[model samples]
Target: MNFAYELPWYRKFINESDLVFCDGFGVLWGAKLCGYCIKSDNRMTCPDYIENLALACEQENISLFLLAGKPGTVDKAIAKLKAIAPNLKVKGHHGYFEKIGDENEAIINEINKFRPDILYVGFGMPLQERWILDNLTRINAKVFLPLGACLDYYTDAVYRGPRWMTDRGFEWLTRLVIEPQRLWQRYLIGNPLFFYRVFRALIASSWKNYSKMSKFWRT
Candidate 1:
């Protein structure tokens, strides 16, 4: 949602997405702080879900198509997933092509031909979401999951912090420390902005509710 504040296209894509669950611990925290009764355990990161999802796909005979990371990274992730769930049928293509023109069309065609039951796009935030928005209608998949950088984590290309840090919601801090140069602006600046927006929205919601209550009593 912080990205949504500045990126109108991202906001629109998120609003249009069939499923927009809270993947960030900060988002879950903000919802709880604003009086939403969401269980902490109910909040899931992509890596966490991927572990279970692979097993479920194996049992259910669901096919998967992975799209993300540099050249070869998706292949490594696919190998690991196959090892974990040998029964799982999966294919993948790296996410390093021109966003427009023939290359993009070719990639979409490849995915459509594969006809995966689930398609996971992990080409980072707004980029992944934008790609989905652009080609979602043309993609032949029962489910489209915008995984951000989860594929990197699965391939061990990126560290998602230790279990302790993640369980305590300090994963962002760990990531900031690990990739300060690349991610400082995102975690350092964007986090505070996200919280501020959440606070303002919470206040607005409370005020609207109070007004409705007062009007109902008066009537």
Candidate 2:
């Protein structure tokens, strides 16, 4: 019952599986294009991500922890989990971001001692993913889900746009409306850059797949 988490490089350990990279905007589309099963429920608040995750932990009877995100967010996140799924059993939890520096031995040490089955790090992409890539072996976990801003959104610490707006793929826009000053850079710069990279990857993958199929038929 070994589940391989996403780390693109960790593919070596996961001979056969999707190992999604925990991004509704990035890996979800990546998985769609690559034929891997990408799983996420973006229901505005989208507690399902953690809800399903809690179910996974309960089924496995393995320890789990929220390893990153703003202070107090994890506690707040847990409350929603309890509210949404009161019966769900969690092994344990912790949170501390911004304060943790590079090498973050304390964080690594704590995780190692508990040896959880899953580590849901919502420190945002690349950074969260990179954290897992750099630390997972040292820490104990079969699955690592690096979620970006998921904790804030899920915990209700931050607000999500209305359902209609979210459905239209402009939840980020609604967010900007709510927290204009704080979110300006994320929506203005990060959002566009994220889509650009996503689409670019899609194009590259499509061309590669077409080339492969064309060569196969030709031969």
Task: Compare the candidates by TM-score and give the number of the best one.
Answer: 1
Q: Estimate each model's TM-score.
A: 0.90, 0.63
Give lDDT tens digits, candidate 2, residues 1-219.
011233455454334434533434444554555576655553223353567766655666666677655667777776766665565544334444442575377777767787767677766544665566666567777767655677777767777767676655677787788888977986797656765665777789899999999999999
What lDDT score is found at residue 209 in candidate 2? 91
Q: List residue ranges in candidate 1 displaced over 4 A.
A: 206-219
lDDT of model 2, residue 25: 48
Clashes of 2: 1
Q: Tens digit of lDDT per residue, candidate 1, span 1-219?
A: 777889888888788877878888888988898888998887878888786899899999999999989999998988888888998989999998998899999998999999999999988878888888888889899999988888888778888888998898898898888899989999888888889888898889999999999999999
The local distance difference test score of model 1 is: 0.88
Error of 1 at 181 (Å): 2.5
Worst 10 residues of 1 by lDDT: 42-51
